[model samples]
Target: MLKKQFKTTRVFRFKRFARKSYSVFNSLHKTVTIGVLSGCALISAHATTVEPAERVYTQTSTDSIPPTELDEVVVTASKVDLPLNLAAKQVTVISRQEIERAPVRSIEDLLNYVAGVDILQRGPHGVQADISLRGGSFDQTAILLNGVNLTNPHTGHYSFDIPINLSDIERIEIVQGPSSLVFGASAFSGGVNIITRKDPESNGFAKLEGGMYGLFGAEARGAYKTENSLHSLSAGYKHSDGYIANSDYNIVNLLWQSRFDINGSNLDVMAGLNDKKQGANTFYSAAHPNQFDDTQGIFASIRGETGGRLKFIPHIYWSRHYDEFQLYRDGTPDIPATYKGHNYHRSDVFGMNLNMQYASRWGITSFGGEFRNEGIMSNVLGKPMDDTIGKYTKSDSRTNISYFLEHNFIFNRFTLSVGGLLNYNTAVVDKFNLYPALNASYRPSKSLKLYASWNKATRMPTFTDLYYTTSTHTGNSNLEAETSEAFETGLKYIHPVIKGSIAAFYMKGRNMIDWVKTSSDALWESRNHTKINTKGLDATLGLDLKEWFGANQPFHSFSMGFMVLDQNMVESGLISNYVLNPLHYKFTAALHHDVLKNLSLSWNFRWQEREGSYVQYVDSQPGERVDFTPFSLLDVKASYRFPHVDLFVNANNIFNTTHVDFGNIPQPGFWLSGGASIRF
Candidate 1:
């Protein structure tokens, strides 16, 4: 039996922004204050922000899918979601079916194909990857889980330490631009939101896999349904001996989700955990080949909506992350005298947000606010502590309060939206700052739309950037927040036979943060660099051959994307760890075709040229600087479908190409993997 979603209903609405009547405004204000403080969860009517979006990617052993409708897809970066056709920002989506058919395994790998998004991996299989958007550094993007911020206060490098199993993801959506005016700080460059919605059509699935380097794994997911409630569970564990010495990893993930109907409102609750242990050879510094890392993350959240004309959405979440890193392996033959004890850190985040909307003849007005507290306890990253918890002996904490209000006006084929976020952070001097945004879209025809956007954003320094101390690196607690003002313009065309989009963006940044050293002999220090300006362009085109010509066409679909980026920064005899090694040029292409009725093949090709250079470290010491080298990779996947079972085989880096994504870190070569799954 398949379960269906339950929705609430709104029968009335006022025309203004909470000022229908003075008394009503006061009552609503009191209600909202209580909701935000007491951690209440609410959901709008039938269709609210982030409505369930289930998309199909292929036609193997299943009925054919209908063509995509532009108006049917919505962007949820704001309190009031808008259709993609009328949106001023561009969003890239990776559907569940696409993930199932891709040659990639980890979420990090899947994001590599995106044009402006970069995933620099320190280890394979989602062990540790730094995610960046546009030409910004990894920490500039806001990482979210089901719309709840999951960013780590310790460092952005651990932002991908998600607790949910890979199989539990419903979709991954990327908004490739600053959303500080929309989703608040750390979305300075972009936002990546992972949604794990329950699938009523799927009773459950189980799978097993094995590959190179003695890799093996098993995973299972199940969904149960009742009249007014649904429950889901997912769990997975994998381990390998590693492709090289000390590169092995073991990972375990577990997640559970439940939803219930309370009167005319909807209630959602979820919890998950992810534990990973891996060798971090050359992950941070290449000076030691025996470096290792272990991390455990736990998170839980609740959200829902309740209201009549004034739709209110309340969200509350909590997450804790524990991380331990070793500069030298525990069993190292000889430890350097400069090597201090291992680094141990713990980060905790608790947050609550209240969003409300009112629709009237005047347009749609949305207002919301969020309260968040992020704290870290670390041996090497924060201020000294009076007491110790386990191995941690230092601590620091900060609170951020953000409020937002926006008005959306739609006149025929034209749409305009203006909003801003009033933000105040305890770590940033406790002063309020306003980040304003303006978005407009014009549709001259049914197939073509032009959009433009302008916004300002800022991101706070992480614990590691603030107070970390070591032999090779030192932090600055006086470092100011990084800020940027960006502008973007783009055009998109949608058709049954062909779909294409082109966009260009420019950003002026101030107080940019980076770890730099005057020379190899000096310790790396975190500093706020001078003004840096960035500009970039990206274009994509896709063709559906089967729809354009006939069903007998040899190829089912083909798509390609290209991107170019430029940034200006120069200093005499200065060495930078990040910000310099960005993608200068990137190209990606994918092709899918049906070899047989039940057999399908997908081919993926990517080429990228990186900028800047990295210093080579040897034997626990910094050596000479090495220039980056460009690399190309090809991957392939084949899938065969049966009545109730699906079998797949994939090969990554099939041509045995050697590459380096970060400083002195060598990437894997050719690898082959296969898997089988049974679906009920």
Candidate 2:
């Protein structure tokens, strides 16, 4: 009955809009009349149509008579594919169309508008950033490329150093709660999975862009497909002169993917490389103004899957990363007592994963196991020794194994899922651990659903947390694993013209990790907090005016999202570095419209209020605590389409707002870029 109400309401709304629009578009009299007649007929036809077995939502395009319903499937929430409406956890899907329409140049900018996601950047154009979810630390989140883990073991700061360019991505799936039951330890807070395109049609594109601060870049992508095989390649290069002294950067990325279908089986292969060299002005220490860094990442993977009632997927992946950092510029003279040396670090991760799924009369069951080996070779980390000159020559390696199982039970309108993970690590004091989760969803009606989940997760300390040492920082190797218990509940409503959801969650953390210091002059030390608690609320609403008011309307779509978070440390009198960087409130709004038949415009806005204070340092003066101020940014994009080419221009931070996402790091201001893409 609820589903019928939704359909009727949408039809009535569309009828009202159609009748009122006849007078507005008198210039195109014949076109307007035909549109109204067709809209009414479609509404009548939709009213008489029968409900299908599976739920589907038709996404209205700018130039379509009747919307076509599509099955929205998701795979990250569980190990197996399920419709978004049936998923037990909160999931956000950013489709390829949405990605291409936005004026974002990097994955970081693309995720900035999502509710409950915080992207704290230290430089422009995604030079570096820390991704946090729901008040969790950066290390708690996991990053994946096509279901293969890409998390760096050395530090979470490099977790977003993905090798794929924007043109290579098909979609991004964000799981917004504890996902260790499906992924592994790094997924303690949440996870992000980027899916690449594998279309069977041959296509290619080339784009060139240049803008403020001497920013310029070029990117190209091409794909070839045959009946039995598909291949794709993408490459990009970007560079920028410094907005200020020693703030310049050069970035390069390359990716290749291939898939082959043979004998009722599918095999996929992927290889990628990312290299970046940038000026890091006061990135790590305020005392250093001419810092430099060069980083490179290489990743490769092979995956094979067999199709049947009983399915199996086997995968293996390898990742290698190299980092070189200089605290001072090359021309700077090394003083006797100053630390002016270059640090070189290398890390590698090799992993194997096997997944299986079975469909039976009772329910769908899935299970998986993973084996991983990771190691780091650094010039200045690990156990200190008398023979070594302030550098550890030996590599530090660790081995870990994890197995997970999940069972989904569907009966009538209710679905229940229970899962658990058993993990073992050779480096931990307790080498074995167990995590459990339970989720339930109730579809009161086809258009509305309610769900709740509870899960437990744990995270191991990173290499930086265990062995890093510097004049102003120190790390302890005796830290315990951070653990948390999370609970979440949400309600979702879906309709032809409108969709929305509201969710509330609470997390309790024990032995939470943070870098802290008691005094301004003391060295920051990595330690574990006794207790921490966080609670938050997230809400999102979207409206499709094109479907309701006809595509000729000036305003076609609008969406808004908001989040509120409150975090507290139960322990008394502790100053932290990363844990205290949560935002108190964040709000995002977006609007899209067609100004003309061939031209379109879109605008996005974000306002954020962050909690806590950071230490601000002046020249030869004592550091002072400065409360982070609230800031708002507006970004606008305009595009004009031709027969085979599309031209676009974007203005970012149009108001030239002066803001700092991190301590003493200034963000770009009033930047503009224009580009054109030609498709073949």
Q: Give the top-scoring candidate (lDDT).
A: 1
Q: How would you encode candidate 2's per-residue C-alpha lDDT over 1-680 as one tens digit per residue?
A: 54663354332211122122223223233323333322221100000000112233332222211232323444467766555666777787777767777777899998887867998888767688888888888899988888778889988888777777787777888888777876677787888888877654537989999988889989998988888988989999889996777899999999998877654356778899999999998888877878888999999887665444454566777899888888886775654456646887888998877666555445567787778888888887665444653354645788888887888775546668898888888888566888898998887877787999999888889888998878889999898889989999998888878889999999988888988887677889999998889999999998899888987688878889999999986643555678877888999998988889889888989999988777788972448877899999999889999988989998999999999888788888888999898888
Against the hidden true structure, what lDDT does model 1 obtain?
0.77
RMSD of each: 6.0, 12.5
lDDT of each prediction vs. the true structure?
A: 0.77, 0.76
Instruction: Estimate the TM-score of every prediction.
Output: 0.91, 0.88
- What stretches of model 1 exceed 4 Å from their correct place? 1-49, 52-70, 570-573, 618-621
Q: Which stretches of candidate 2 lie over 4 Å from their true place?
A: 1-70, 333-337, 384-392
Model 1 agreement with the true structure over 1-680: per-residue lDDT tens digits: 11221111011112112223323344455445446543653321111335443221111111111112234345665556655665656777776766777787788998887776778888878878998787888888888877778888889999998876667777787888788866667788888888785767788889898999988888899999998998999989888888878999999989888876554445678888999999988787777788999999999877765443355677788999999898887999878787768999999998877777775445567887888899999888788889888888899999888888887765557777888888899987749999998888888987898989988999999898999778778999999999999999999898879989999999888888888888778888998888778899999888988998899866888888999998887552467777766788999998989898889999988999988787877775788887888899999999999999989898999999989888778888998989998998
